[model samples]
Target: MGKGAILGSAALALVSAARSARTVATWRTVRPLPEAPLDKGKVSVVIPVRDEESTIDGCLASLRTQRHSDLEIVVVDDASTDRTVEIVRQHVAEDPRVRLVRTDGPPPGWAGKVHAMYRGVAETSGEWLLFVDSDTESAPDLVGKLVAAAARDDADLITTPGRATVPNSGWWLLLAPTNVLLFDTASPDGSRGKAVGIGHCILVSRAAYDRTGGWRALSGEHADDVAFATAVRDAGGRTRLVDGMDSITSSGLDSFGAVWRSQRKSMVAGGAMVGGPAAGAAALGLGGLLHIAYGVAPVLMSLRGNGFVRLAGLAAWAAQAAAHRTYMVASHQSGATAVLAPVANATFGAQMLDAAWRSVRGGNLWKGRDIR
Candidate 1:
């Protein structure tokens, strides 16, 4: 009834409606790389590994099951102290399609992963190159489906917002949905400026990669995924972001701390890409604040006896929550995680701010390597 209530209700309705529409659109527009047979092409899967001993074995096990007959798997081991090399060597002995390359270190000014990727690409001769992470587990027909999708869409690069497999820990539940939200919000389209290539499972044609200058172009980036997509777009190549949930999944973080720490470099890079740290931080902070307002404003208005505003706020909150739930379900993640949307939002906002601060202060570190 009051002017304050009227204004608050309008804001809530608009934010809720906008988010709901995006959620529905994301689900409706982005379909998984469909299961289809592809005409045989030499497809190379390049995995850049560090100290991924815990996950490398399962990753390799899944790769060995890929149904594509002409597939070549190149695992480039960056100077790791763990048993990652040993685990990969065991796979090499068993599967002739798998080869292991050891990297002395990254070249001058190159990120470790970038160096490993370049080396891996050099060792393979496939027409289509898939740069996958060591933590990823793929379905037997993943390569077949992705190759077919790239061909069908006439896209040069295919990046996935990977289906993150959360651990049994409740901490994972609180933190994981933030990743989904970030992907859904920041780069809804796999456009040039806002591209979000999930580094864990990126599929790009050798031609497109080469056209974009390949790893060399993105050598300085901490978040190779976004950088890789951006480079492809800048080079006049088409890039598409698809649902790879059916074909691939990835897991690694065992706790909330691990998730937070691991995300810094990529988050910092993301902020840098979207203008600069201050602007990126503001955008992220506003998004999270808006979500919080949607959930909290109604309750506050109701306490102030603004029944109409209260009703609007509650409806908006419910709609926003439903939208998140729908997205999670479509993305093959747990719909239950949607209940923690507020927490996820706050966590995301905080992470973005921290990343921005770290970027301003000077670079950050990933896997003991400095990311500048």
Candidate 2:
């Protein structure tokens, strides 16, 4: 390799090593799920659905068996064209704790799921409220455990991370870079300027939620979870992201197209919400560049370069893979996915660029709604 090539590879190697170190450290601080059995509070689990027939039943099946005896499950339907409502009706007849709530749909200026969530909250009277996506499933003790963690930590709102299970190994490999990247950087508490939230499993106290203005405040928001968490923090309430990987899972976004749309929507909407067009665009660009450089560059150099260039590339790739193992294990993903980082990074970088383009050019839709 030329001197220039060797110098560039060595520089990249150092950058990846540094980034990997920081990523590993941040993820290491994420508190694990509480193991000790604890007291259960009166909790209401609200599931807001539009057209989720394929996954709602599995979600309910997971909730109904909750060890938290003092619990009520409310499945709010927002005019699902499919059998989502009918499926919930069957569960309602069987489980006394489960109730079905119907809503006409969101009024002007309100997002669909946000409107349903608002309506669902009105029908319940629990000290704690859990807003779960219809595609997500929780372990029996999930509610009890989160409630306990919240109480012990004085947190008013808690978000448990659950990346929907990717069905195709190849698709998952494509997604691995972004997943590990996010898992490494997301704040475990709402200490950042705006908290990034996991929509599928949000646990919040009714008191704090009401004080923060609840879903009503986020009626028009496409990024409702992040908006809600930000509201909680703005109101002086504590919002935390806890480790619920072992207890929560979701069967969502099964196809590559679904994955692409989901990522784009969040990137476009989340960036706009946080920093408007310019800052968000800049952030996405920088992040995409980093992911590509860290994940893809080294692998290429390792594969094609000679001598020191190849060695530096190999070292960087090894460092990133080792750092990524911590997150993979925490999220229950196969650690072997780390080897696919190059493909994953390229996929993530492309998605981010897509988001940036859509942001400036306008028009990204979700369920007939223009999110960006």
Each model's lDDT comes to: 0.73, 0.78
> Could you give candidate 1's per-residue lDDT for residues 148-187 as a string of tens digits?
8888788888877556676433233334445445455455
**Structural RMSD, model 1:** 3.4
lDDT of model number 2: 0.78
| Candidate 2 local lDDT, residue 126 | 96
Q: Give lDDT for model 1.
A: 0.73
**For candidate 1, which ten residues in a row score worst on lDDT?**
168-177
Check candidate 1 and list the clashing pairs.
none
Q: What is the lDDT of residue 2 in candidate 1?
A: 75
User: Which digits, one per residue and each the tens of the lDDT, describe model 2 over residues 1-372?
Assistant: 577888898898887687667657767767876886356679998999988889899999999888887999999998778899899999999999999998877899888888999999999999999999988888888888898889778899888777557654534544555545554545567665566577878998999999988888888787788788878888888988778877888777667777787778878877776677667777777777766666678888899888999999898887777666655666666777776656666777877887877776665356655664
